[model samples]
Target: MHSNRRINVDPAKIHCYIRELDRSLLRLAKSSTSIKSLTFIDSELKRVEQCIVRAARESGNLVASRFGGILEISSKGSKTGKDLVTDVDRASQNLIANIMSETCPGHVLLGEEDPPDKKQEASDWMWIVDPIDGTTNYVNSSNIYAISIAALYKGETVAAAIWIPWPNDDGFELMHARKGHGTWIGDSKLHVHPENETGVPATGILSSFPRWMPKAFNINKQLMENQGEIRNGGSACYEQFMVAKGSMQYAITGVASTWDFAAGILLINEAGGKVMRLNSDGLFENFNGWAENYKPDPQTYERLRKWRGLILSGPPRTVDFVAANLSLKQPRLFTRIKMLFNN
Candidate 1:
């Protein structure tokens, strides 16, 4: 009778156990990339995606809990004191790192808050994280902040997840994707807007203006006058995620790093949009390759820590149009003097 008696189970505990099982399967899949086993690959991708969702949720919750409260503000860069790092940022990163470690043991962790201290090995299977993609926005009490995570296997991104801290309820907004699988927000899949059939070109674009890259201001102004409108949300992840979701025609910025745009790059690709970096010849080339087979030596890695140039993302035609219209040549001394006098 003791053995035959029915036993009650906590549904929450069962859910947690299932989540663990998914994470384990995902780790197995990530470890066996060379085999190209479709079954394992698919299953593992799903699992990595699950881990991403879980991490994003937990991190977002922590952010929400601390919102509107007094935060410990700090700085990272020396001399300039331009870049800001807050206690919330560190706490959020720590939360994500801890959660990911619990889910996938032995997987390498690389985060913006705490980057890899030692040389990055070629075989490193990495989870790249940006605990708060829009730190300034969060500090200013804006809703554009988000948590981003991506899984890199041999330098290729196989899965990514980003969570927007919004509504202050219902678990926030989420966007995610896998290499072959489509991108999605909540339960709905995302797609780039169809090309305008009426023949009139898209008038507006989304863009960024880093304080360090003021030279691009002239071109950005030109885009605003020629195009219908220009917008800067102060959040790199939000801009790219919006592009992938068809809310923006394209995104332009002076420069970006892996953590700033890695997750959203996959989203745009999987959503049938394009991402490119301008070349010296004034032609657009796929910068997506930067995320693949990336084993840079310390010097090279430091150099690539932040790249400078035109970064654009959108439908092919729109991106090409913007690239061609914007003048790539830096203003001559005379031109700069004339502009300053005119202003």
Candidate 2:
């Protein structure tokens, strides 16, 4: 009879308990802040860093617990019908939002699962979250997924954390960074491999849409032959983590949303890497200048929600070399017509 019995559990209560624990820890840490020399902005960023780290950890646990189990999956109605959203994704985002609400009240939340109107309220602080960065990977039982959380103050990403599953262990590791503080996995500060600067062959990640594959094939081929091994891990955040940790020399993604790469951008930048994006002029340009010119407003949040672009990131030298060799110019009208006819 005991073997046939089922145990009932309340996920809501458990989530509440976790939120309370996070709040208590935040309070305790704040009380111990004896340094009076820190600027107000710096102090706020430090607190946000602590909160985001805990939020990522808790959200990662939620995602890990559901892996390989029965998942309620749906599509985001994309043209390819391949953009998936699982129940775990919703649960993870909700858990993160709950924690942020309790710990950092009044901050605007820009989450993957939230509607655009949610950002209509203008606020100085914004939390950008991709609860499950690799939902498709998670659904397929791959461990390449990640939880990404970032805090933006005045339209600048100041504190960020990414929770990635450990390959050999059954646990997760959180990689976090503050704006001026170097990226960290625990106490060790992360720095991109200096070998990347020497242009030695090294592993790199490359991704593009299926339609663009033909055009990108030459670049991919050249990279493999001259730059080293080429891979696509399907998760932008995971690829960014690898680059930040010096495991990979660079990563280029043809399609990425703000939430998909916000935290990863900060992590890579903090790790002494560089990031560039494709511009309308058919060239890759430095991407770090946005924060310098950003003007915070409700409309800015709206624009961020709709933002999508090609991003290339890595050590400064490697990124420049890769960008210089890449040919992303759009096809001419005649060329497009000829390709359609050939197809």
Candidate 3:
């Protein structure tokens, strides 16, 4: 019975396991990369994916504990207004980190919810994870939630998987990717929908502003003028999946956490798309400096360590075009505190 059980969630540790998968895929693709046993790689990638789902399930359990069992939550303030952080996030991080370290001791782990204390840069083998990407949705019980995990052997995102436990009834959907190996959601290969007229179509092209950025408050205004459409699904993991799976052109917003976008971005990139700072607008299209820029509240750093908003995903031309237009008079206000204080 246990052997046939289908897993339904994603976990941080999956990033660690992907390192193993990438290694195996490298050899498999080479044909002669290895002359010995081959079943090992096949079995192992499956196992690695299982590890991701398992870890995500554990993370989900920890979150459920907070929602139903614990009320000891605190606010991260207006930046992440109504978003609450709990001991559960820390507890889950610790659990996932320990397991990953033990399994792939050589892999450097960078998590979204809990980043490394030491500021050393990510190296050849790094596991990037967002134990829970949509904390706000998780806390509000409004859906839009997931665990994101990715493997980056160097700065390049190598392989990734996003497992959502609930889709229709908060159930599950699994997406997987490996650099140069193509992307998959379940048994299907993935591709971003090419843009229509602009040659790119981003689903979240004009999602409502974060309620904080005054610069782009008129996103709807501009969308109407440009004759384009925008869509919002809820979670970064989901948005990225849609982009990779070719349902939407791309997804873009602001203020992304490394973990929140890690797995999804990797999936998009490995699938032959792009993700970069909205300011650059290089990933999808080109920036035109049309919309005023917006900065995430500095307090967001304290609320969640690794963040700068997320541009979920989409076709390169389409996304780049939007990013090119969005400009902020006060971009990253928090980072410029020293300059402000000096004045």
> Residue by residue across 275-323, what tens digits does model 3's lDDT show?
6554332222322111122123333223234334435355676566555
Which stretches in model 1 have alpha-carbon errors above 4 Å?
1-36, 79-81, 115-124, 168-171, 197-201, 204-226, 280-282, 291-310, 331-343
TM-score of 1: 0.75
The RMSD of every model to the true structure, in order and in angstroms, is 15.4, 19.8, 16.6
Q: Tell me model 3's lDDT, rounded to 2 decimals.
A: 0.57
Q: Per-residue lDDT tens digits of candidate 2, residues 129-236?
A: 898988889889999988999888777788999999996464878999999989999988999756544553464433222245445434655554566556777888
Off by over 4 Å in 2: 1-38, 78-81, 116-119, 168-170, 196-200, 203-224, 289-296, 333-343
Mind giving the per-residue lDDT tens digits that candidate 1 earns over 1-343? 3667789999999999999999999998887764678777789879888998889888888987887789987767774435677898889889888877888776666677864354543334567788888787887888887788887776667788888865644847888999888999878999975655431236543444344333543355644455534678777788887888888777775454567776887888898887887565455577663544356344434433343445678776766665666554454632442332110
lDDT of 1: 0.70
Q: What does the lDDT read for residue 207 in candidate 2? A: 25
* Model 1: colliding residue pairs: 203-228
Candidate 2, lDDT over the whole model: 0.78
Selected candidate, larger TM-score, 1 vs 3: 1
Q: Give Cα-based local distance difference scores for all models.
A: 0.70, 0.78, 0.57
Instruction: Report the alpha-carbon TM-score of model 2 versus the true structure.
Output: 0.79
